[model samples]
Target: MASAPHSPLPVQLTTARPTVDGDHTGTHLGRAARRGELVRLHRGIYTDAERWSDAPPWERSTIATVAAAHRSPPPVFCRESALLLHGVSLLEPPRDVTVRTRRSPEAGVRRPAATFRRDVPPPHPLRHHEAPLPAGMSRPERRDALIRGDRGLEQTVLPPDAVPWCPGPEEGLRVEPLPLALLDTIPRMSRPAAVAALDSVARGSRLVDGPVGEEDLLAWDGFLRTKKARRRWESCWAFADADAESVGESVSRVLMDQWGLEPPQLQVRFVVDVDGGSRVRVDFHWPERGIVGEFDGLAKYQKPELLAGRRPEDVVVEEKLREDALRRLGLRVVRWVWADLRHPTRLRDMLLAVGVPFRG
Candidate 1:
């Protein structure tokens, strides 16, 4: 007389297809679907709506791309989709999905949500006889490989001097190489965001250590045909600093650069005699102006790893002590958080109020 045990939450949409067979009954899935517990991502794929809603836009895009890749003739993850797979940051995730296919580019399949492009052979797909992979390949290339070894895709020849990506052992999805992904991504981003993305890759975060250098990017820029794209991008690239410690810092630097503010020395160290000659590192310092800037990401206190076994209040107290020490040294401290970064006008005003001059 007991009701059937409720169906367990399905696996992440990227890994499994929700269907009404093979341990997944129509009755159970249908019940969940009707109850608003499951949302259909693509044909045959269903994921928890709550989880999908909570995931970052990039993660959601990835799930959708993986689901669409499972179609009869899978599409090559290209353009934005390819960039998502490469873990590159975007200004904003696109609502309209893009995929490349060899299926004659059907207009019928083109919908408000999805766009399919016809994969054509490049006029001159790069082939370096001496290079193991390609001219700008950071790693080796696989001639015929499955994305995650499950989904099948038709490999398209890359354009002349195109960069190629190699697969990682555990990365769940196949993606274009870092350089190619950047090439596709830069044009789509705003000037500042594009610089942020480029800075992120060049700096080599824990997630991705891009192999492309500034000079390499310059060479690649010559291959792009978009109007004024290379000129503007070069400016951003030139402004990019691998020294930025976080995305917030990187973006803030861009804003400062755009406003024509004098560049502050990054990650400067000061030996404060307070608390027995303790040394401290400041995010941005202008010795001539006697100003120090701090980008206060809450993670410093909230994240257990960053806290390093110290209590949140303890970290706050330590920061206060550090600030007081800096003040004693005749330096003015200006602090900003994520919210301040969003209201850049207000931020600029605050900095100007603190006597941080901008170049006219």
Candidate 2:
């Protein structure tokens, strides 16, 4: 999957003539959308279809968030939306563009009041309409502002009693503070995703030499106003490890735990005899089992900095030699990729096949 671009492409509003070629009148814009030449991100908002198609889910969410922010009284982004703005890694793209509002849910309101426009099919179904709306919003006010196209985009307003805010990574965008965002976010995430987000924050803050420290947890714990929230926070925090070098590693660790496999030491280093006794760090190491596990994210082979002037094939060969050296040291090496994570049973079988021991 492609990493997010340094900057998002410009969004176009139908109220003004778009800078691109061809007639940019409202009718023409609608025609362009029907022809799949343009993608509608929100009502009156548009971007190039090709670019939108090429963007990964997280980037797409970011683009949609930007589109929504173009409106007046910009929403204070939170949850996954805030995480994306904060540059935190997520296991999956969020289901909607989430914002925070101080408005309370109506006494009788049990379901979301947002309505959808089905004139154009979205790239994927967005469940923004499923999120509850604040009390006092009229039927029209509850209606989503986005014109569904290729992929639907909708904003979910979280009606907490008091919504806090901070400056977003991008100027003019308001977001929840990182701790508050994580507290709101992790509870709703799957174990792998929750750990990935926490690991990311721990890595970024560098507040401690290892996993998030007691002080950090206490600071975050203070933000919890409810026992339920505190329990959720503690549950996710238990899996966090700062040593997880990447999202893949973080996710792999969480899955291993969930599968009841023996936990592996992360980023274990060895002074191999190869290449003048160079030191190499492996992703996961089980000392008792003599096993090394690697999560092969495409970034290692595709990112320019990671390649470091070496071709992808050369990197593969180097990895093979590294594995050979580890084998010589009587260690069994096992590897998995992004796809394997999606199939838990397959990953579990792979580990078992390689004699990865389960927890006692």
Candidate 3:
């Protein structure tokens, strides 16, 4: 109901068998789809009428496909096949199914609506998936079986030895380890996908219930810092002390506190001269002194690529213009740079000289 019941435990390799049961008529299936009772994913893969109350079925199936591959190994789903199996996020959603596997199956194996990819392991195969299955071939044996007829137990990953990386549900067709999944996906996955995975397992909430091992998650922080690709996620870094709603604001808040200035109400808004229809949103506000501190970052005045395209003179001129405008409205404006945050105490003294008391 919530998720396609975890692939029936001990499920068999269904490659040579019918994916869907032979029970009811196609008409009943058609009616359900028409009534939105059964949402058809791809073709024969159908999910309950009601999707996961939250995420789409694709995400659920990503888990399921991986399960299927595990239930029946010797055909490690990979590449596009692997992508299809894991529900890896793609821009236009891939048409050709990809997978990474050392060997290819029969020559003319045909899929109903998707093309199966045959991948040779890259030096670093994305072989991060693995899990041990129950030791049996019973009614639900198919859920964790490897070969046809549920013959033997073959691990799912192409190189089963590289089990530390893959994320799956269990030992046999099990879900990959959530942390390893996050790490494996970080370099290759889009920010949203990678972020989603990280958010799912790495959130403060999950950490509470997690069985934390001796491994230090923060060790990866240094590597993430040097990425230079997208630093916005740094907001979640263990050292990022601010709780700004967005990463930019988070960085700004961290700097403000580091500088020892009394923290300001973020996104502060106050109406200005009514007739002038003036209004301002201060990045930080010294409410007691009516002094506003704005943290300037490239995203606002300059695009990320150009870093600081504004001339130093232009920056000074703009700051002056803004200061004048705020002063006209009876508000004093102060600015902070990225460097100031490194020595927030110095900035704090400056604020104190300007009549803003420091609790220090």
Candidate 4:
């Protein structure tokens, strides 16, 4: 499998003299911010306003992580932050930008006793946080940390004897190793999110060269730290399918399981005798029920690679004709979109309406 192309890191500027973008004084930065030409990501850290506005939530979070690295001593990114740096797919953007530090919590600073847990409900889609700055830092530094923390940056102490992190996508930054990051993150994700992330990890991403085999996943089991975390890892890994080609399909599978629907085969292919015996792969299939499931993500129509230079209307027509061919094969087809996934009961009702049976 070829690696996906990586997006260029957003251009960032700082108050430091002779910075990456250029030398800029505090006064100049302040003026830019006031003029709405630059968006402040952290104290003294700014990026082009247009780029900030154009980035997706996940990319925006990644940009913020880069901003955090500008502090006196950067933190080692972990959990979703590390996954984002690794180019792994996330079901939703992180609620907070998490980093691991060797610094101890200073006096009066409170930290979550357990930052990662499976039982807690997933965070709302929008990002928010209230992380406090560590005590003992300079006043300006403390204020900078506090401001970013309010915008969802968190710092956790690194565990004793922790594994070393790998070099990050950017210079001078480090992230937890992919396997360790997966173990630390997946246990805390919602079931669907966890499975989707694991599927992406197993299938590989930009930073990862190829599929992460079962051996690699098992290798990290010893790092799981606790019995509960181990169990959560097991439960999640059991449902992870590398055949899930996209986050949408992965989430749909989890929804099927949650609604007590029988498991369906993923990426099932059918040989159509059209266009010289072309093979068509469906997102999901239940041969026992003669049903095919498609998760209709807008990317299919919007992404240039998927569109293959064809117009959106043409893609829609091709999809309709493909559905007709499947119908000709006597397969009941069901389709749902991101909206259906957001409304928990909507997808379940759609599948049930199509006679997708519950698990016995």
State the TM-score for model 1. Answer: 0.70
Q: Quick one: ranking by lDDT, best first?
A: 4, 2, 1, 3
Model 2's alpha-carbon lDDT is 0.64
Candidate 3 per-residue lDDT, tens place, 1-360, comes to: 111121222211111223366654545555655665554333433344333223334344343343344433424443333433333322222233333222224222234322121221101112322222222323244333433444432213333212222243343332233233333335555433333333333323323224222274343333232344225444333333222323334444544454565666667776654336566667677787888766654444443233366665676675566567777878877776545544656555656666654545
TM-score of 4: 0.75
lDDT of 4 by residue, 156-259 (tens): 33332121121122335555667777877788778888998888876775344345666766755555666787798889988888899888888888888888
lDDT of 4: 0.66
Residue 318, model 2, lDDT: 93
Deviation (Å) of 232 in candidate 4: 0.7
Worst 10 residues of 1 by lDDT: 121-130
lDDT of 2 by residue, 205-241 (tens): 5221223356645544544656776687788787688
Is candidate 1 or 2 superior in lDDT?
2
Clash pairs detected, candidate 1: 165-177
Question: In terms of lDDT, which candidate is strongest?
Answer: 4
1-360 per-residue lDDT for model 1 (tens digits)? 001111122335422434655564535655565566665555445556566555544445545555555544444555566665555544455454566432232312333211121221111111111111223332223222222343333233323111112221132344455555566557666776777666666666523434467564554453345556556666676777777766677777888887889889899999897778889999998788999999887767765667888999999999999999999999999998878877899778878888887765
lDDT of each: 0.57, 0.64, 0.40, 0.66
Output the lDDT of residue 132, model 1.
17
User: How many clashes (backbone N, Cα, C below 3 Å) per candidate?
Assistant: 1, 4, 46, 0
TM-score of each: 0.70, 0.72, 0.32, 0.75
**Weakest 10 consecutive residues of candidate 4 by summed lDDT:** 121-130
